[model samples]
Target chain A: MEEVLRIEDLHKSFADLAVLKGIDLAVNRGETIVILGASGSGKSTLLRCVNFMEIPSSGRIVMNGRAVGRAVDGKQTYSEKELTRLRARVGMVFQHFNLFPHMTARENVMEGPRTVLKLDPAECARRADTYLDKVGLAWKADAHPSELSGGQQQRIAIARALAMEPEVMLFDEATSALDPELVGEVLGTMKELADEGMTMLIVTHELGFAYTVADRVLFLSEGRILEQGTPAEVLTYPTQEGTKNFLRGHGSFRLPEPQLD
Target chain B: MEHVWDFSALLNNKQLLLIGLRNTLILAAVCLGLGLFFGMLVGAARYSKKPLLYWPSTVFVEVFRNTPVLVQIMWFFFAFPIISPFDIDAFSAATLGLTLNTTAFSSEIYRAGIRSIERGQWEAGKALGMSYGEQLRRVILPQAVQRMLPAFMNRAVELLKMTSLASVIAYPELMYQAKIISTIEFNPIEMYTSVALMFFAIVFPLALLVQRFELKHKAR
Candidate 1:
């Protein structure tokens, strides 16, 4: 498998408090890696670092074989232009839908292509329609985000990210903000994307979704990867006590039984 | 016993009032245009995190906003000329004072408007690979400007009134001409009333439009 992203000795700190402590990760193309962690375990921070949204205190983030930030005097330095270019290829969907409320769903999806890509209007519109259709909200394209339900808005946000045709997609608790019933639609859209072999790094609490969709599942505890393995290994039988306690905390939910031939 | 009201002298000098009105309009228009244009730059500078941009803008905003506009006009007319590289005529002095004053106030409006937008909107723009300028222009301002329209209109109305201050420097604005007419014609009541009516005619409609916009914004 081709490696699409690599993080080496990643560290992130906010003032004196350390959020992400010496984390390392490599994601392969067409891989869906699910990160499961308790609140404040730095799952979101890790995802944010990949896109350079939160600059890692010290780390090497190599995407598609190129280091993201330039090294100046042995310290990583990021220029706004470089970060902008980096973000163009790495799309992110936030927990809050974050759709531009002033713009219609179609225009929200069209914005990146129209403004950044500088594509012709017709092409941007066409791409918007295609992606909105992909997310099953083609009919709602003309509607503003304020008019759409949480699930529908999330779907439109997904379309907006997809319109950029990014090399990788990061979902930072995308469905966590939705109502219980609405979670299904967003998770369903994500499942379809996974099925179609999209490279994804998702920080989510949805253990059931992780069980079914993840190529690999990582359990993070206290700013470090505590355990990682196949869903059957990590979810069914977590070796580390921290992972076990974490799973036990979510004990009310049941994981699917492994298929036996 | 009531003194009889006479209008013949005032009517004869109506041409002077017309020029005054024209000067008032020109000064207001020029100040508003330059103020809004520069206000965006100063506002963005104040909003920026860099100290290089932030400090100068902070000082500029504070000095212009805290001091009285009347004093500012007087300073430019009387004091600025001593230190000023260029000549400071009455019109130039008034323009300098009023334009800077408008810039200071309107920049606060712009800053507040931009700040009111949620952080998520900026993140969303960045996530889609937009530079700071692009994000502001395309996503943030498009929304902020909607919330800011009424405030800007109010500024314009205030600016229209503020132009009358130019008359203090004897620039022959509406108020200055009215002062002359009232003194010469001995019809202070009628002349002042007419000048007030002219100002009301121009400003009232704008006030109504601002109200309409506020109501519409609330509806949305």
Candidate 2:
């Protein structure tokens, strides 16, 4: 499979503190990479950097062989136009759902196609319906984001991104804000996308889903990828001490065995 | 020992009052329409990141808002004709003053409405590949405009009241007509009372309608 995204020596700093340090990774077409880490581990920053939503302090992001932002005198640079074009190919689903409150679900889904793709209104409406149905939200087509439950809103958000037909999808803790019961529905929808071979880079702490669906699992610690491997190697048997500690904190990722007395 | 609250003279001059009422309404509507247009531009400028646009709009809003409206009216009516090469009648002066004053307040209201929106909405638009202009038009403004409507309506009512300030420039609006009628008829109480009632009749209903609209939006 062709490589869809590449990050080289990415670094991000705010004032005096560093958030991401010398990060390097590559995502292949149709590959699902789950970034698992504790809070402040810079997992979310890495996903944001790929789309140039948060510009990396040094190094570069190449999406489908094109540099995301410009390079001036060997220094990375960004413009509104450049970021916008990069964002078109990289769809993002936020943790908060972030649906446009004033628009209906169908309208929210149609917005990208109409505004970015400049699709005809009728075609936008048709595609919105198609994507809504794909997310099992056809019945709620006219419902506003405020009218939908958290899960439904997240599903519509996913469908909205899907309508863009992006080369890559980034999920930034997409289910973290959901009620426990609602988490499964969103996870199920995402699992379907993964099963269909959608290229995805996800920042999440849902270890169970990560174990089953992730093609590769990257455990980040203090702005660095501490450990990464297949689910069995990373989840079932973590090699690094930090990964082991994080898995132990989750408690469910350990082998099924006798309890301590 | 006895006093008669007679309104015959004012009543006899109903045509003058009607004309005044008509002129007042026309002035208010025209000024409001123009003010809202300029205010939208000023508000956009105030929110813009570029200092070139932001500073001039900021100074315009602050200067108009802090200075006296009557001073502004006289400056445009009296001093402006002297300072500039052009000329303007009392009616034009009144309209310019009222519209400029309304623009300052309306721009502030517009700024508040735009700022009240969550940043996440803008992020959502950007994440969907929208340009800044597209994001503002399709996403932010639609939501912001809903919030701005009630405030805009209230400002319209306030602008209607401020139209009376045009009387200082001898513009033939409601207050100017009332002042002339009172001076000629020597019934200041009845004439001014009538003027106050006319203002109440127009503005009270407007306030109630805006209040109702605001409540409905809050419920949503």
Candidate 3:
């Protein structure tokens, strides 16, 4: 019910080409916000810049009242170690899951608490087991990411981040890389998290899931917020030419299935 | 002329032969041990992105590997004394030379093995909130060690054979010790046969062990 994240005037560029151009946004605590946009619309970059994974050329970002991603002035810079420490409180679940191949799911989950938080072995193991169990991965705790299915790997990745006990979690196209059948399991887990009052920011194109689950749905176009409202408002009524065109562009078109010939 | 082969020569002077064998073992053990340590450091240095760090390590490997081991021996035997104002024996110089040479080659071996590991290992560690040192210790090194074991053992055998180079340095190790006894007594074949057998006794088993380990790892 309270504002947990705020972004203003976000601008990002790679060489001459601009990716994100002057975006502003806010999310309340315990709300799930799904960001929808086509490829190269700067949605992913904006998500990355929000968490300071990719530095914004210029912007303002505040997460839980701590300046999350942007160094607005010369005075607000933090060292690499300090930034890593700060990131522990605001977890980012990558699009690819990015689970460590060498470590077991349990160890991967325990690593954050053991290293960054300096939690002892017993406590780390306990929390890791708890979260892994939460994701229904208790049996697969000893398995490596390579040994798990795509959906299972993503779930473990989410559990790994959750083990850190972060205040806010960011999901960057979490289910984009999954098989069609596997997508549901990961989404189901996200729904469970959302129901538990978790503050989550998700970048996804799963329109049905977004409509059913998201507290607020944001339409990103050309690196700016084109439209944003409750899912009921934006999905059905719709507004803004960019938003309408973006939806119509996707809704009217279906991928051509390969012929058996 | 002796009427029959003198296998007893080895049995009769077994004490002196054992001492020579100890010197040989010392050369192989010390050089290879130190070589592996320094090699891992150089290997890691080579993999670093900065040209300043990688180039010097690359140059060191090239200079030692391209040049002959015998020449490296002579350089240590002759030039090491001049380079170092402090006087040390040929044995020390030879040991140091062999280690540096082995390090040059083994570092590259290790570098290849380390590089062969998938990049995903590092990404996973980073995503887990691990520091670089922790990632290396927990994830990278353990997996790399498994892959590198065969190459490391092969380097050990190479180091073992390289101990023969110490004969030129007046260390009186295995080959030199045999040469000394043969020069005194006219039985060249007997003394050299014993030395060959000793090398076989040590190295052949180790080489076999490596092969077996490699096969088992493949089966896995």
Give the Cα error of residue A79 in candidate 1, in Å. 2.6
lDDT of 2 by residue, A1-261 (tens): 799999999999878989999899988999999999999999988998888778789988988887767789988888888889889888999999999988899999999999999989888888898899989999999999988999999999999999999999999999999999999999999999999999999989899899999999999999999999999999999999999999889995567777899
Clashing pairs in 2: none
Candidate 1 DockQ vs. native: 0.80
> Each prediction's DockQ?
0.80, 0.85, 0.35
lDDT of 3 by residue, B1-220 (tens): 8457887766776777788899999988999999999998998899889999899999999999899888998888888788888887878878888999989988987888777767756655554556678768877788788888998899899889888888887887899888888887777899998899889999999999899989987996
Q: Is candidate 2 or candidate 3 better by TM-score?
A: 2
Q: Best lDDT goes to which candidate?
A: 1
Q: For every candidate, give the share of true A-B contacts it also has.
A: 0.89, 0.83, 0.33
Q: Which stretches of candidate 3 lie above 4 Å from their native place?
A: A14-17, A68-76, A237-261, B1-4, B49-51, B216-220
Q: Candidate 3 chain A: minimum summed lDDT over ten consecutive residues — where? A: A69-78
Per-model C-alpha lDDT, please? 0.94, 0.92, 0.84
Tell me the docking grade of candidate 1.
high
Q: What fraction of the real A-B contacts shows up in model 1?
A: 0.89
Worst 10 residues of 1 chain A by lDDT: A252-261
Q: CA lDDT of A101 in candidate 1?
A: 94
Native-referenced DockQ of model 2: 0.85
Name the runs in model 2 displaced over 4 angstroms: A252-261
